[model samples]
Target chain A: MPLIDEILDLAGYRREDLYVCLGCKICSSICVLNEIGIEANPRNFIINLIMEKEELRRDPLLKYCTGCYACTFFCPWEIKVPDMVRAARAALLPSHPFEQAFSSSLELFGRVYEPYLLFRLLPYFFRKGYLRLLVKGLPSFRLSLPKRVKTEGIFDREKK
Target chain B: MRYAYYPGCSLKGSAKGLDEGVKKVFSALGDELVEIPDWNCCGAFEFGEKERILALSQANIRKGREVSSEIIAPCPACLKNLREAADSSVSVLHPLEVFSEASFWDRLPMKRDLGGRPFTPYYGCILLRPREFALRVRDPMEEIITRLGGKVVSSQVKAQCCGGNLFFKELEVSERLAKKVWEGASGDIVTFCPLCHLVLKTFSEKGRRVFYLTDLILYVMGEREFL
Candidate 1:
């Protein structure tokens, strides 16, 4: 599928929105591409996608996106480039193993830890006085996560 | 007013000052901040690379579900992570947003000065585009800055990421970005996020003043009357 079409299907962005884009290259000019030594250009990517090209979606440059929304922020028309890319990513979700693992971990973390464990450990991490202050500032009751859920592999490598 | 507070990892460690400052202010505001129990790390900078949306959004939704009230995150990264998580069911707001609302604004004790200069308000990345939150702090921050003999200047660059986490992976890139942040500002940069504080502090070459919002608040509150 064409990247733009796939993204439009997911995000509901219209073709008229693309017509307003002037290709001024402002998005690329301010982009931190050189910092990472990648030639990723939002303008070119959008233009290619609009042209019904498939190669643009397969570009290795797409992987370099930090999803920081820098391009979207600088765009004069307020085009959501990050959202568009996010949609494209959703289409390609099955291919990325790491992302799948990470997402699974979020669900697992909530299921495994209970309120009692968090309450005891949380205070130790904060300053004694600050913890007391936190307790005082908070409401009188405790909130807990769900009791059980399937756990997954989010961490394959340990942090050094 | 009540909020579900997510005080990311740094608040317990290097950013303890933020925890102290927020507590004092929130107490004064007569607001209740309920910490989301059993909250895991927001996955910070690493999650973006691992799973752009799901990893970021799940932590937020999980916290949002645990707390009935809106989630008030003090850390800019945490706020950004949650907001970007793509979860629509729960509302995620910055602590400043809660503090700045008219109902709670009046409750906060506004002090005039710090070392005879005005207090400057820095809205780092996450809070910059959110007009409501930024506007809320403007008046009070300006009042405090003026009393301290300091001037408040808003910068387009204030919203830029501090590039701290990117440092380990890309040192030169982070440094260059940090330099741009420094060049874009006049006087000290005051921010609410701990990650921004750590990044700015690391990149600061000498004589460049960077302060966490809590530090300035504490100075003003400590110098004046207690809540």
Candidate 2:
């Protein structure tokens, strides 16, 4: 549980926040992925973390959490499951190509929707078989990536 | 009143339609929107560290203060991050809120009514959830549309998640969820956030038109956006 403590510190949560989740599955029922039967319940992550199931931290399902906060609002105990999900993510070892692309993009570009950074994630997108959707959606919208407000030093101060 | 504007990267990038519409609608409403100088992206979903998120989001707020004490953000994600990162010194406003207020109703140009086109306001998750930042106006979108002489399709899932949050990480679940939202509505869709617009516009079936709030407002004012 010492490792859990360190991760909690990383995500800025008190240990009681994890203990507050009673496995009610309220968060699961409200989850957008779980609503469509994708099994991306945030409750599962909390339980696994409590059990010290370290291997599950790197699960692809963890990536499905969009941190939408649907669960956080519905939780009776007021547990911030998204925070816990992030805590679990802090422990992830970048096993999946997504883990690499996701972090490196944020670390290097200082933002998520960087158009050029999508190339870095192509390997992950291809692996997830999302290439078709990505390709189809690209042309419908504008890409103001070239004119994006310069965000140079923001990433330098905090190396998360 | 003049207000500082923070068009987060999405509105400037993938969601330029809303960005353009924001300028047009605000001008038509007789207000000026000043872009926050050197405003960076409000990092909520990106920065995992609490301090990092606050630092980044607050930095945008600080820049916003240089222009005005009250700031308006078109993207819900950006609004949420800025609101969460903000303290008592300044206030963050969703453009929808500014447009929905009863006092501002007289200011609507109303060049032409919505022509009775049915519009469903997709408030989406980020805009409504976590409660504090939720729009106080009951049925802001419906009321505005109805007031402007448009029909509104009533649906329970107005605050539903469009899967934009998980869009980059994956698509199947996000796509299905977004489709359910679009198909659930009876007519055209009006969205406040660019991610919501992107998701609803991308996966939605052919012939279904998704409108950003600003875009719809502009159209009603006799300026059809150059779609």
Candidate 3:
């Protein structure tokens, strides 16, 4: 309940704010993912979550959300739906490889290493004939060091 | 004028063309762009994840501090992230926005001029989001397009997301968004964000061209060929 309240509060959406969802489906109509066979209709999903209908609470379809803010951009209610999606995503980070890698990369290198991630995800591309990208990207593939700034190490320094 | 330049992750890798073009253009304009050493990637597309994004930007700022306080990055994604983490300590600027400034344009060499072709300036997403930033910028794309003797042909998808970070996470979503931009544009598209350029270039149909703002600027300066 605390987490739910936080998620809702972060978006400035209250229990009463749920009534403002006119069911106009404007948010859903504008979502590109919804049109592309992804069941990412914000109207239905938001309503479900707001009503505490636990069925769709943690729908896997949340992964497809790119955090583009399109629904928030187009919504008449001006609801920050993308924020909600990201909050849900943050909660689901333990299971999603891509997101987990994003976090781990930041933890390890202090930034997401694109080439490393690409190499790790090579199977997804190798099967799709994008192996050439690996070859083309080979020249730039290396552990990036901070260009000019030299810190002892991200974690090595004694906590001030 | 001189500023510390932070060329984010892509600049060293896939977007090196942007790195080269910006350096070339800045040099041509009689300005020195000192690259911020040990600069790390600005964590973009980590929407609503302020803590993560801030840490990455702070890591970059700690590097920038070793240089000068005023920093300019060519990518909107980097600029937005850096600006958010920037406190009273430093200034963050996007080169495109810098180029758009009337004072800066006044300083440009009179000899360099790109032809007046009607090209659509795509802001994609990063530049336009947070609404206030967009307003503060006051349509830099149009300003730069006009400065380059080009026409600004805006489209319905002008302010929409180009699915930048999503290109890796979800290809179809990225393709769909890029396709919208491609279809909506009237002529050669010029974008300020390298991430947007990559996505648009990948999904644009044959015969269509997407140029980085630096690409257009360098082409106009006769340092590079048309994009």
The CAPRI class of candidate 2 is acceptable
**Tens digits of per-residue lDDT for model 1, A12-78:** 5777777788889887876655444667788877787688677766754355554455666678886
Runs of candidate 3 with Cα error greater than 4 angstroms are A1-52, A55-61, A74-79, A93-95, A100-104, A132-160, B46-49, B110-112, B133-135
| lDDT: the better of candidates 1 and 2 | 2
Ten consecutive residues with minimal summed lDDT in candidate 1 chain B?
B129-138
- DockQ order of candidates, best first? 2, 3, 1
TM-score head-to-head 2 vs 3, winner: 2
Best of the candidates, TM-score: 2
Q: What ranges in model 1 sit over 4 Å off? A: A1-22, A29-40, A48-68, A82-160, B43-66, B84-90, B103-105, B110-112, B115-121, B129-149, B154-156, B223-227
Summarize candidate 3's per-residue lDDT along A9-98 as a digit string, tens digits: 544456676668788888888877765566778887777667656654566446677666667677777676766766656554444455
Cα displacement (angstroms), candidate 3, residue B64, comes to 2.4
lDDT of 2 by residue, B1-227 (tens): 89999987677666677788888888877899999876776764654567767777888888889899999987877887888888898999988788877666788777777778777877887787777766555678877778878788855768887888767656777888898897688777877777777777779787777777777677777788442
**Candidate 1 lDDT, tens digit per residue, B36-129?**
7656556554432335334544755675677754777787666766776635577777666565566754565666545444323655554553
Q: Docking category for candidate 3?
A: acceptable
Instruction: Compute each candidate's TM-score over C-alphas.
Output: 0.64, 0.87, 0.81
Best by lDDT: 2
Flag clash pairs in model 2.
none
